[model samples]
Target: MDIGFASSYLRSLFLTSLFSFVAPLLLMGSTIAGLSIISYVPWLGRLSQPGFELVWAFLRTFGNGNALEGSLVIGSTCGLVGALFDTYIFYRQNTFRR
Candidate 1:
């Protein structure tokens, strides 16, 4: 491949890889933050305890049975893992490229 072509291709790949790794965590963190804020409401609080509610329990277990910081920690860890997964997928895609 030509030098310029290779450089551009690498730049694109780098950006894609970076975005894939960061976007999910940012989205997840924002969602978790928004939900945490919304859960302060009385009625919606009740609706949040079936599926994603375990986050609270997990957070509580981490701290003094409280679900704020713990949730963030858990969510961040999950996000990091997710980012790693994205990186792995990028690697695989590049490896299998035609």
Candidate 2:
């Protein structure tokens, strides 16, 4: 493998993993914030109960430490799958170039 290509690929894989790790936290935060704001509306407050319960359940699961392990397993699997897909695309492009 070319050193430059390898380095670039590794960098991309790292970034993909980093994003995969962070994206959920960001999404959860935003979702909670949105729900909090929505709950302030009287009519919508009723609807927010289920959403809050769902988020609470998620947090409760995480609080027990299961979520961390699950997230790691799932995230790594997804990252590896993404890396393999990227690698295949890169290989196909290089092969075509040659």
Which number leads on TM-score?
Answer: 2
Q: What is the C-alpha lDDT of each candidate?
A: 0.63, 0.73
Model 1: per-residue Cα lDDT over 5-95, one tens digit each = 5687667656665565566446646767777777788998776555356654655786577666555555556556655665677578768
lDDT tens readout by residue for model 2, 1-98: 88997899789777876777666666666878889899999999999979976876676564564544544555566667767777787788889998
In model 2, what is the error at residue 65, expressed in angstroms?
Answer: 7.8
Task: Give candidate 1's whole-model lDDT.
Answer: 0.63
User: Which stretches of model 1 miss by more than 4 angstroms?
Assistant: 49-52, 55-98
lDDT of 2 at 75: 53
- Tell me how many clashing residue pairs each candidate has: 0, 0
